[model samples]
Target: MSLSLEKILSEIEQLTPEEQLTVMGYLVELVKKHLTQAQPKHKWSDLKGMAPYPLLSEDAQEWVSRTRREADEHRERLLQGEE
Candidate 1:
């Protein structure tokens, strides 16, 4: 069926608060599903060595490696605690 702004507004006005909320929630989910489906999927092979990374300074690289090591150590501690 054809939809117009006035008709849609009238229908919305006719519904109780709960029905209106339900309709809005369903509409939001429909929009999200459509958007996700519309996005193009990329294959790893399609990217040559994955996207190129910008040149990083030696200091930045060292900082990143240190931070990663610390994070891994912390994660291991957490897992040991959980056990």
Candidate 2:
């Protein structure tokens, strides 16, 4: 590692736990900002037809409704002590 990095690491090591946590939170926010700036921005229209109908071999609304019904039935059975 570079001398500057080593020096910074040494300095960080001397910080109290609370100070270290504060520094860590600052670093995390900096990293998040960098990542957001680096990513390409996309408009909603850009995702159009990305997954056309039947992409999952089922209609989206039907799949959603079917899954909800199945989940409710399972939960009802579990509440009734019927595995």
Candidate 3:
């Protein structure tokens, strides 16, 4: 373990049970937010030619359009009470 982590753990050990729980919850949320913000937000151009398969840009666009249309149709059917 790193020195910083060790010091934090030692300090946490001195806290009362309720305070410890609060600190633990805060740390959990902090770590979660940090990890979420660390994720890469790639643009379409960034991933343009990175697919393993031989898929063209037009092919990808078509797939997206078809998928969205299907989803919309499904949602409409559901909304109309037609499972």
Candidate 4:
């Protein structure tokens, strides 16, 4: 819903001390909601290789490849158990 400054001022004036606090809380929540909603959605795959600096060493790269291959083979073996 669209809000006008006059409407907001009138609403503020109508609020009790406790209600005013609630209104402030609600406004903060509203700002957070809108901000997060406006932001673009992303995925790990979408940002793959986008790092400003490389975070892996040559040994770490080798370990990652070996671990991934082992995990794939283990997954296949587990699937074979199901069959």
Candidate 5:
């Protein structure tokens, strides 16, 4: 709609596939930079009590055990080349 955008689009259309991909990657990085600058940073204490349920020590232990078991199984499967 804007003249600048129209000009950019016309130029992009003329680029080779690889050049277009490079321009797209550059644009993605620019968008990520703008987004990070616009967002606010949070401290760990500020996120306290954010969970719906209270997290107890036992709950944490159980979670660690389950994750470890799953990871070990995954590694075993990978070593065996199992699909």
Candidate 6:
């Protein structure tokens, strides 16, 4: 280790037990904050090209309506014990 680090370590060793624990806890929190801030922050535009036009073989609005209708029909069948 470097001389400066060795000196600092010696100083830390001379502290009371409670002070050492406090320093350790502070260092842990510092590392946690750094890691949390290092992650990327995404925006709506980030997903702009994730799904291209039409998204599927059919029109997006038409596909959504068709799926909703099918779900309602399936629910009715189940409700009437017709499944």
State the C-alpha lDDT per candidate.
0.87, 0.94, 0.89, 0.87, 0.91, 0.92
Index of the highest-lDDT prediction: 2
| Tens-digit lDDT string for candidate 2 (6-54) | 9999999999999999999999999999999999989999989898778
Instruction: Sort all candidates by TM-score, best to worst.
Output: 6, 2, 5, 1, 3, 4
TM-score, candidate number 1: 0.49
Worst ten-residue run, lDDT, model 1? 49-58
Residue 1 in model 4: lDDT? 42
What are the clashing pairs of model 3? none
Tell me the TM-score of each prediction against the true structure. 0.49, 0.51, 0.47, 0.42, 0.50, 0.60
Candidate 2: lDDT over CA atoms?
0.94
The 10-residue segment of model 6 with minimum total lDDT is 49-58
Model 1 Cα lDDT, one tens digit per residue, 1-83: 45797799899999999999999999999999999999989887887656445435356578889999999999999999999
Show model 5 residue runs off by greater than 4 Å: 44-83
What's the CA error at residue 77 for candidate 5, in Å? 48
Task: Identify the leading candidate in terms of TM-score.
Answer: 6
Question: What does the lDDT read for residue 21 in candidate 6?
Answer: 95
- What lDDT would candidate 6 get against the real structure? 0.92
lDDT of each residue in 54-76, candidate 3, tens digit only: 46545767889999999999999
Give the distance in Å from residue 10's predicted Cα in candidate 1 to where it truly belongs. Answer: 1.7
Candidate 6: TM-score?
A: 0.60
Residue 63 lDDT in candidate 6: 95
